[model samples]
Target: MPSNPTLLDDQPATGAPPSSPSATTIGDLEAGLDRLQSQGPPARRDLVRSLLPVAAVVALLCVWQILSWAGLKRSDLLPGPLTVAASLADAFADGTLQRAVATSLLRGVSGFAIAILIATPLALLLAQVRTLRAALGPLVSGLQVLPSVAWVPAAIIWFGLTDATVYFVVLMGATPSIVNGLLSGIDQIPPQYRSVGTVLGATRLQHTLLITLPAALPAYLGGLKQGWAFSWRSLMAAEIIAVGGSIGFGLGSMLQQGRDLSSMPLVMAAILAILVVGIVIELLVFSPLERRLLRRRGLLTQGAS
Candidate 1:
């Protein structure tokens, strides 16, 4: 009897019995995904979108160059962008920059992977058990607030100046944020989602796998992004503080070496390298994944910042 065609479209067709709620929800999600996929913007717009950030970075570097030239006497203390670039080039030519980047990235990736494996199951367990959540949720959140650098000394003492220490710091830094993100996602799920799954005869595992996870993905992915940031930061701290000849030289070690030699250009170069690596990971890995997810959920429009 509804006058709206859209309303009628959702209703049973020609006296057919109503579709189950779970079926209706699934169909809606699939239709939304397809619609969003077809609505993506033109390639030209995507090109422009990508160029904006590059332009901003160029402008910032120009300003840095101007400032460095303005203060000739302080140039030794505060090297210009060009000086930093030249230093970076020298490091690259000697393969020090490349080796440091490779070592740091390997540790970061491995630590983050281990954190994910540990956090996911622990998060699920905490979500299911009210008593455990009540007892441990605050502790997990508290851990996230603690600076990752603080864990460096403890890790060094417990595991020595080896790779084990770096990984321990990374795991400690990343896992809490991931756990909190999943728990928060689970909390946000509507009661009807659980009821619908139960009514459709879904087993406990089926309900979690099919319904819970997909619904919780956005927040979970956010947590994963934050977790990676923490892991990288923690790895850097451990490398700087727990340096040993046995451990491979990483970006942190390069920065520390610069400080020891009073080489401002090398210090600036190392810092720039760290920033570049983080930006590359963000753009090449997380950004695309996040955009795809947001677009699929109709929360983001193509070419929108």
Candidate 2:
């Protein structure tokens, strides 16, 4: 049958017109989402964030100085910032503090490096093997809670007053942390990730390198940070106890010497040096790396850590 032209014209269009409000609304929604996903905080906000910590430190120093001024009778016991700074300068000029820092950093970094090497593979094995993880998992967690200082006496007995003793202590302190961190990261992975990898015929190594490791990076980094802390603490404990050993004078030994000489400024200087080193490392290395990683993942929000 022939359709009338008016009847055909009266039929409604199947789709919205190109310039319709609904189309425009959908387009606007998409653009908004894109902007939200891509944009971060402004540069001015970042600058303010960078300055905040420095301001806090300055405030703390001011308070410390004021307290020292008020406590004139106990000035020798609680040396002012100036006294500590002067002691640091003197130690630096005489090469004492420099040597101590160098020795400690070298030992801590090297020992931590070795600990990573030993722990990564061990953790991987335990993570992959059900029986091994079930057997050793509790022990690994327990080790994290154990005081690293507890190992000093045993380390000395096993290795005597040698660098080996210090390294052993550091290993004992750091390895468990790394192991636990990696395992925790791996455990947190959704089971579907493994299933996807398996369906794609990925080898075990490929699965780990491409899928598991990247997913677990944040946790692994956290573990590494904790491991470094444990390494530094263990090294200090060993150095303080085994000062006469071949390990040379480290920050802990420097502290011990200050005590032996009954010099409060030197003691405070040593303590400050240790703190500065820890802070410097965190600010220079881990903090930037963490920010970068988290930003890449879109996990770091503006004005947040």
The numbered model that scores best in TM-score is 2
The lDDT of model 1 is 0.89
User: Candidate 1 clashing pairs?
Assistant: none
- Model 2: per-residue Cα lDDT over 188-221, one tens digit each: 9888988999999999889989999888888898
Prediction 1 TM-score vs. true: 0.84
Q: Scored by Cα lDDT, where does model 2 land?
A: 0.88
Which ranges in model 2 have alpha carbons more than 4 Å from their true place? 1-45
Q: Backbone clashes per model, in order?
A: 0, 0
lDDT of each: 0.89, 0.88
lDDT of 1 by residue, 94-169 (tens): 9999999999999999999999999999999999999999999999999999998898888777777788888899
User: Model 1 off-target regions past 4 Å?
Assistant: 1-46, 301-305
lDDT of 1 at 66: 92
What is the Cα-based TM-score of model 2? Answer: 0.86
